[model samples]
Each structure stands twice: as structure tokens, then as C-alpha cells.
Target: MASFLSAFSMFGMSSLGYRTGFGALFVLSVNLVPLGALWYYMHRKTFVLGRARSWMSMGMPFGERYGNGMRAVIPVVVLLASIPYLVAQVQGIGLMVEALSEKAIPYHMGMFFVPVFISLYLIMGGMKGAAWVNTVQGIFFSIMVFILFFAVMAKNGGFAPTMQMVFDTHPELFQLGAKGGKLWSYPMVFGFAAAMCLGCICFPQPYMHAYSSRTVKGFKTMLLSFGGICLVIITMPTLVGIAATVIVPGLKGVQADKVYGIVASMALPDWLAALAVAGGFTAAMSTVNGLVFGNATNLANDLLKLMVPHVGQKGLVSAARWSVAVIMAICVVIAWNPNTPVAELSVLAFGTVAVTIFPLWGAYFWKRSTAAGAMASTIVGFGINIVMFIWGGKNMVLFPSAKLFQLNGFLAAFIAAGLVFFIVCLVTKPGKIEQKSLALFFHPALDGKLDHNLVDRSENEYVKV
Candidate 1:
């Protein structure tokens, strides 16, 4: 449990660690608008209304009663999404180590270190071991953030001068326009907002917490607190990045992701610099642990058990540990390429999940959603996103567009899939079993009872068909 909390904290912090002032400004501008609303909703649903419990209870429904077919789909998509995300985290670890140690530790060696440590602790202590390590690391990261912020501020002549310098140098960054003069285009802003919102809900790390929390209310509280922490951490890094633009304006050809490191090394004293590096490393490790564990669980619970029904609980847990090790190794190899940007990689990972599973999951409680329609929508949505990713024109592609198309792949997929679902359900008939299952899962009257009669009917109908 400690490790899990640490992992989440790291993931949240890391998201902000790489942001430069411009990037941070961009993210904050978007987040600030809806953050209050999001917080209120989460507080009411997770705490006051207890909707989080409803969300948690929905996890096992497709597995236990929807049949193995539904179960089979989850692990494949989850593993696919998790690998790149893990690779990105590993890459971040490598970059941080190389920057801090002044190349005494090669990037490749640093990459290997995270996977090795994670595999060892996870294999030895299971989730509990991982959680403890994360807890300790999370504390280290938080301290490092405050230390770095103060050090940077002092170096740049404190907050007022720092703000003045940013305003003078990069006035456009502070501007609110959406065109050539603005730092971020409207489409990029909206795309980022959509991805972040959907990503949180669909992310395996968050979902794992949902399943592991002591109660629904607890889960909601943790997420809300975590979200608030994320806003602060992300804002700080952006401020640092903005400060970097003023102090180190001539840094040529350096990507925005590396701005934080560059600023820290140039502005802070040695000890603070070292702490900054450690904080970045901690962030990467936390995200890696969460993603690797998420993949392991998906494989063990959603895939293996479904494919091989006789696998016992003990056997499944053992397999999950081994799977974590193997998956971490694969992610290490993927991280070796060292070409992709961290933000792009993160978006790609989250975009895939948002496009493929977000809508399907949302349908669980919506009474009109049909299994067949849901399946078709998922297939088409994923198919469209993949096609756009592979063949869309230079400007239209999601990742590295030559000309910005404004619309991201996930948005395209979401629209496409949602349309398909609506049309298909309107045109076709839903199975009786699906309807009964929906009612059993969503109906308030069930009061947590599994309607066995509906299950029997579903099985009988399946046999007949």
C-alpha cells in the first residue's frame, strides 16, 4: 500500500517535473478553467454521494458475468497502452541520471537501474514492497520540489523580478490568445484537456487504487487530494521553466522537456541540483512502478485467468509478480531508442486508452448501452485511431504532424466510436441477456446483489444461441 501511494505521488509529480514555464503555463491555463468544477464534482461524487463505490463495484462485472470474451479484450489493450508509458518513464529516469551525474552514469545504465530495482522489490515483496519504496521516494520528491523552487527563485532575484523577466522575454506565453501569437493553439489546449480528463479516469494506476482502496469514499478522497497536489506540482515546474527562459534564453536546440534540468543545473547549488535530479528520478520510478504493476494485474487477472479458467488465486498472484519482471525488461528495451519526447509519449499512451476504452467503460451504467453495440463501437473507434495514426496526412496525424490538424487522434476516435454506438444501438436489437445484466449492474434496487436468475438466463440463452 505504501508503494502504491508512492507510485501515484511520483506519477503525479513527474507529470509536472518536465514542464517548462511555457508548457506549464499552457497546462495551467487549461486546467484552471475547469479545475474548480472537476474538484467539486469529485468531492460530491466520491465523498458526498458515494459514487466512487459504484465505480469500484463495476470493475469485475464483465469478468464475472459478461463471459470470457469481454474479459479477453482488456489485457491486450491494457498491455499495449502500458508498455510505451513504462518505456517513457524509464527514459525519464535515464535522462535525469545522465544530467545529474554529469555522464558518470550512462543513460543506458540508468535505464536499466529502474527496471532492475522495481523487479527486485516487486518480486520479493509483491505490491506491499513496491508501495513502501514509493512512499519513501514520494517524500524525497516533494522535498526536492520545494528545495528547487526556492533555490531557483533566489538565483533569479526572487518572484517579482522572475515574473517581470518572463513577461518581458516571453510575453506571448502569458497571453490568452489562440492563434499565431499564442504559445498554445486552441486545439492543442482542448486536446490536452480532453486527454488529461479521460486519462485520469482510464489510467490503470488510478484504477488499481480504485480497486485497492479501503472504501469508495477513501478512493475519491485520495484522487481529489492527488489531483490538487498535481496542480501545484505542475504549476511550480512551469514557473521554473518560465524562469529558465529568462535566465538561460539562448539554449539552442534543447527541447522543452529538458528545460527543467538545464535550469536546475545552471541556477542551483550542487546539493540542490543533486536533489532536483533525485526528485526527477523519483517521479519516473513512481510512474514506472504503477504502470508495470497495472500491466501485471491486467495480464494475470483479466487475461490469463480468463484464458485458463483453472488458474487458482495463489497461482494468479505468483504469475503477476513474474509478469511484472518480464514486462519491465521489455519496457527497458523500448526505452533504449531515446528519440521520442516525454510529453508526446505520455499523450500517445493516454490517447490510446481514452480512445479505445473510455467510452466502453462509461457505458457500464448507461442503460441504453448494448454489448454488441459497445463491441462494435470499440472496434471502430480503435480502428479509426490506428488508421489515422498510421496513414493520416502529415498535418492530420496525431503524434508528429507537419501541419497541426487541431484534432487529436483520440478526439477523432471518441467521436467516431460514440457515433457508431449510438447508430448501431438505434438500428439493431440488444440481447435479453445484455439487458438483464445491465439492469443487474446498474439498477439501484439490486442493492449489491448479483441477480443469479439473470445470470442463469444469460447462460441458457447463450447455450441456445
Candidate 2:
């Protein structure tokens, strides 16, 4: 999941540091809250709800526990959310490839190359294949960060001098409102971080990845490993971004996203710059594969199987492979003419899907969480998110005439989803169907004692209540 921080995402991270200074690190660090949430909620959810058939079954924990409505809704949302992110990864690959080859390869060609090459192996290897690739990619990106960190520090006359430069020249970036005006206020930072945490926890791909783990120990292993890896990998981009501000100042608009690439190309020797491109490639490619594979799996297992139950396991794999090819083709076209900034694109994806947070987590802990509530939260919350996105001027504002800082679309949608969930659940009692489904995730001590009441609480009883 750390690889989900694509090269474009790293670019955004660094850009955040370049513009906002130390404040950006706070946004990156809040990722752990979701990791902790995953450990507590998803780990058990996967075992209890996901273990019935193949761990990789279509509806997964959501469908198994919630009902057919959720089983249907989650796959479509997961597939849609994966698109922009896939484009971002492809765009990142295109940027670095073009830079490394000095424009010989060109952006369009590089974009095509990454998806085609990765998909070839990805189709054959599946999730387990992605696991092996991610391992190597993770190590390579880690080494890349250390090398860039030390090199940037050395070029700026060591750590103390670098800190002195930022303090003396750009100290205003640290202030909540900055010196002259507000760029990144405390509230905005909190919202962005919280949105990111929620998105990561509820994002479909990561849920599928969690389900792939064979044991509780493996799940815990992933939780710990992701936490430590994020701490190291996420911080690297910030340091590099801070260094870029000092060394290569005055980058504007889309140019700022290329800060790390520019700095590496200029500051390092030719050989190291070539290696840096490879590092970026590794980062972006790994993420692209995971996103593509996860979405493809959803399309095949969740959607197709429901349509054609006679499809065999081999047929499903073939369906997944074809889905990857088709999705990558769509992403290539989108990457060719992306107008949004890499960071905003990422944050936008998070904000849009963050509506899932309440519905997803509530299933595990909230006993009264009926399928009606889950469906309401998913549909209404997502509807509100889209409304806010348009009302906020795409990616520009929280709502009409409001700026980016105050109560953005993500927070608005998240709050709306929670309110709807609670209100709907309270007003409408759970039907016998929902009560039976809920029993799987109930506390073990409640077993046997409530079976009678659960069996007796039919739709008729619910209507009377």
C-alpha cells in the first residue's frame, strides 16, 4: 500500500514541502491512523467475513456481512476510484521516463510502455506477483530516497546550513497563515490528512490486498511493515522538496511537481540521474500494477461472475487479464492530456471515495448498522461528494465561492455520510435478513443467546416496529 504513494504522489508531497515547509510533514504522518484502523477492524473483518469461500471471493467482507446491495455497490465504486489513480501512476512514469531519456522516449510512448509491460506480467502473476514486485520496488525506492537525501544535504553545505537557509529566507511558510497570506492553514492540513487516512483505510484495493493474507500474523506483519515503510518513504519527498525550494526556487504551477526530477537531474552526475529515473519508474510502476490488478479482479470476480456464474476459475483469470488491458488503454488516453495537478488529483480521489469510511468501519462495530444504513451512506454520501465536487468548482473550493481552506468537499461529504448513516439506522429497524448477516461480525460472547430473537425478527416485525 505504501507504493500507492506513486511518483506523482511523491512529487505532490515534495511540492507541499517546497511551498508549505514543515507543515506538509504533518499531512504525510497522519497515514498511520488508518494503518492502526486497518489492524483493528479490517484484520478481523477479513477473517470472519472473508474466509467463507476463497479469501478472494467477489463480495468479500462487505457483501458477505452487509448484503447484495453493498456487494454490488462496492465493486463499482472501487473500480471507478482506481481510474484517476492509475492515470496518476502512468503520468508519473511518463514524466520520469521522458526526463531520463532526455525526451527521446517522449511522454506518450513512456505512458504506453509502463502499462503494457507491467500488465503482461501482472496478468500472469496476479496478486502474489504484485507482492513480489512490490518488495523489490519498495527496497529500490527506499535506497533512492537515502541517496537523494544525503546528496541534497551535501549540496546545500550540510544539514545545519540548509535549515538555516529555510529559516532565514522562508520562515513564513511554517506559520499557519504564513507571513503575507494563508497558503496552508492548520484546519486545511487536518482535513487533508484526515481525508487521506480515511481514503486509504476504505480504498478497495487495499481491502483486497488485506484479504489475500493467509493468516492473522501475516496481517499484523503487513500493518507493522506498512507503518515503518510509510514513515521512511513519505518523509523522503518532504526533505527533497525542502531542498528543492532552496536549490531550485521559483518553480510555478505544474513545474513544481517536477521539482524532485529537476533537482536530481541538475545536482547529480549523469549516472546517478539515470538511476534516479529508474527509482521513479519503480515507484510508479509498482503502484500502477496494484491498482490495475485490483480493479481488474473486482471487474472479473465481483461483476462478471454475478452476470455469468457458469464462468470457471480459468475464465475469471482471463476476464481479469482482459480488464487490465482495457483499463490501461483508458488510462493512457487520460494521462495524455491530464489538466489537474498530480497532488490535487490524488487528494481529489481520496476526497471522493472517503464517503466509504463510515459505512465500511461501522459494519464491524455498530450492531444496529443495517444494510439500509450502509446503502444509504454509500449512495447518499457518494451523491453528496459529487455535488460538493461540482459545487466547489471541481478541485478549487470546498463549495460555491469558498476557498480551499475552509470545510472542503471531503470533510463535507464525510460529515454528511456519518449523519445520514446514524439517522437512517435509528429511524428504521434492522430486518431479520440484516440481523442474521450482522451475527457474523457480532462479539463472540453474544453467540447462541440472540439466535432466537434474530431468527424471529422478520421483515414483518421490522415493519411493525
Candidate 3:
């Protein structure tokens, strides 16, 4: 996920930072909100269920607690929302490739090469392969980000002078509500932050990582470390974005997306600039590995196995590998000539699917939550965003925390979905399956007790709720 801060985010954040100034940092504030919620509730709810303990893949808890509608639809909603984001990352790589090669390779051809390599490894090693590659990628990009930061700052003389230049020309950009709400306002930032936290629940990649954990302590430690990594990764890009205002100004629309590359080529030596492009490519491909694998895992483990009951283990493995190829093809085609800015696609994806949080939250935190409610809210929330996407046409206000009348479309979806979820959950009651599932989750001692889907070859016994 640290790669999330690289490539597309670097490209997107720099562009967004040019527009929003410091307000772009709000994107990294998930630790403050969701960490507290998890500590108080979700950890107790099913934290232990992750340790080689279940047949439940992706949002299986929802299926167990609610019904098959959630099992079928949640993954679909996630990958649909995720494809735009996958396209964003792929496009970021394509742009960097074209730039570094000075158009020797061309954008159309450059984009196809990396996903092929990523899909190859993921087919052979699966999640373990993706993990090892990301560990190396996370380290490389993290260092490159700070180097790019200093390279940009040094070009403008130094840190103090960089801020002074901006302050002298456009002091207003320093404020969170820069551009008089054309870019970002306080309400917009708050809404986007909420949307991201909620979206994390719907996103399959994080949940997939959890299943790798052997203990609660290890998981919590890993989660906490990500906050520090986020601060380091996010801070430099914001500075670089702000620095670009002076280094390369008057850029608008998709032109702004190139600021990260343009500024790098102008400031650094040719060799270093080439390395920066490689950094972007590494960052992008690392995330491509996860996004493709996560979606395929959901399709194979969560969706396919349910649909094809007679399929053996070998069949499931083949389905997962094949599904990765199909997903990569679809995303690459969409990415070929994307007009929307990279970061815009990413955050929009996050905000749109964020509405599913209503049902997701209700599942773990509220006993009254019913399957009917989860199904209704997921579809309705996603539908509301689709309508706004169409209505907004070419100029979407919800991108980069831009909002109108202090109401972001993401926030609007949240309200509509939350209202629908609460109403339906109140009107309905649990069935036999739901009751059994609820008993399993609500139980103090989950593993080796209740109705768990344990592998039966586990090691760590549950500490008991």
C-alpha cells in the first residue's frame, strides 16, 4: 500500500498539491480515524479470524452475517471501483516511460510491458510473490521520494526560499481552502477523509494482507508502521507539488499531471531524471501487482468458488491466474488513452465506493444490520455516485476534494447509503445463517469454538474475546 503513495499518487498529489497546496496531506490521515475504530470494535469482532482460520476470503464476514447477495456484490463493487484506479497506476507508468525515453518507446506501447511481468510472477508465486516484490519496491520509492524532494528544493535554492517564493507570489495557496473552493475547502477535505476511511473497508487488498498475519500484535504493529511510512512518502510529494508552481507554472488540466516528471527532468541531471522515471515505474508496478492480484483473488476465491461448487483446488488456482490476465487486459485497454487526471481517477474511485462502508460498518458494529440492508446500500451508494459521474460530465467537482455548496458527491453518497442501511436493518431481523454467523463473531473465544471455518491445521490458539 505504500506504493499507493508512489507513481500515480506522486503524479496525482504533485498536480493536486499545485492546486490544493497543503490540503492534499489530508489523504494520509486514515490512521487517526480508522485506527481508533478498529481498536475499540473490529479487533474484538474478528481479528483472530484472519490467522489461517477461515474459508472466508475478502468480505466473507458480510456473507456469513448477512447473505449471499453481499458475497456476490461487494467484490464486484470493489473491482469496478478499483479498475479506474488500476488504470490510473498503469497510465502513470506509461507517462513516465514515454517521458524518460523521450518518446522513444511511446505511451501506447510502454504501458503494456510492465503488467505482463507483474502478472507472470503473481501466477507462479501468488500472494507470497507479490509481498516480496512490494517489500523491495516500498524501500526503493521511499528513498527516491526524499531525493526528489531535495532535488526540487535545491533547484529553488533551499527549503526556506522555496516557501518564501510561494508566499510572495500566492500566500493564499498555503491555506487549506485554496483557490476559493475551486480546488479544496475544509468541508471537502473532511468529506474526502471520511470517504477514504470507509473505502478502505470495501477495498480487498488490505483485507488480503490481514490473512497473512500470524498474531494480533504483529498486525497492529504493521498497521501502526504504515502511518509513519505515509508521513514520509506523502510529505515530500506535497512539497514537490508546491515547488512546481514556481518551477513550471501556468499548467492546467492533464498538463498539471506532468509536473512531477517535467520538474524532475528540468531540475535533476539526465541520469538522475532517468532514475526518477524508473522510481515511478517501480512504484506503479508494485501497486499493479497488488491491485490485479487482489481483484483476481476476490473473483477466484470469493466469487468463483461460490458459483462453481464442484471446482477442485487445481481448478481454483487456474481460475485465479487466468482472471489476472483478463483483469489486466481490461484495465490496460481503458488506460491506453485516459483523459481524466491520474490522481483524480484514484481518489474518485476511493470516494465512490466509500458508501459501502454503511453496510460494512453495520455488519461488524451493529447487531441489527441485515443482509437486505447490506445489499440495498451497496448498490444504492454505488448507483448514486454513477449518476453524479454522468451528471458532472467532463468537469467533476468531487476530484481532489473539490466540492460545491459544501457537499461532496462522496459525502452525499455516504448520507444516502447510511440512511438506507439504518432503515433496512431496523426493519429486518437475522435468519438462521445470520444468527449462527453472529454467534461466531460475537463469541469471546472464536477459534477452536463456535462455527469457525478454520483450516484445522492451525497453530496459534485464540486468546479468547
> How high is each candidate's TM-score?
0.82, 0.89, 0.90
TM-score, candidate 1, is: 0.82
The candidate maximizing TM-score is 3
Best by lDDT: 3
Tens digit of per-residue lDDT, candidate 2, span 1-465: 544757655666776688667777767776554565454455455543453334474356666567667877877876666676677778766765675677888877877777888888798787888889988987787788778777888887987898788778888666664245566665667777776777776665566655666555666666657755776777877888887777988976655666777778777888896676577677778877877787788778878877897999999999999998999888888889756656666776777677777667767778887778888987887787677667655554322124434677768777888899889888888777667756456644323322223323321333233
For the record, the alpha-carbon RMSD of candidate 1 to the native fold, in angstroms, is: 6.1
Overall lDDT per candidate, in order of appearance: 0.59, 0.70, 0.72
List model 3 lDDT by residue over 1-465, tens digit each. Answer: 553554555787787788667767765564234543443244334445555346336657668778777888888988898887788887877776676677898988888877788889889888888889888887787777788889999987999999899888777677766355445566767766676556655566666656666556665666666546566676787789888898888977766777788888988888887777566667778877887788887787778878997888898789889989998899899987868877778767777777777776676667777888888888988888888788885235374323555577767777888888889878887677667666555543443431223322222333232
How close is each model in CA RMSD to the real structure?
Answer: 6.1, 5.7, 3.9
lDDT of 2: 0.70
Q: For residue 114, what is the lDDT in candidate 2?
A: 79
Once superposed on the true structure, which residue ranges of model 1 sit more than 4 Å away at CA?
1-23, 29-59, 64-66, 181-183, 250-256, 356-363, 392-405, 445-465
Q: Which pairs, if any, clash in model 2?
A: none
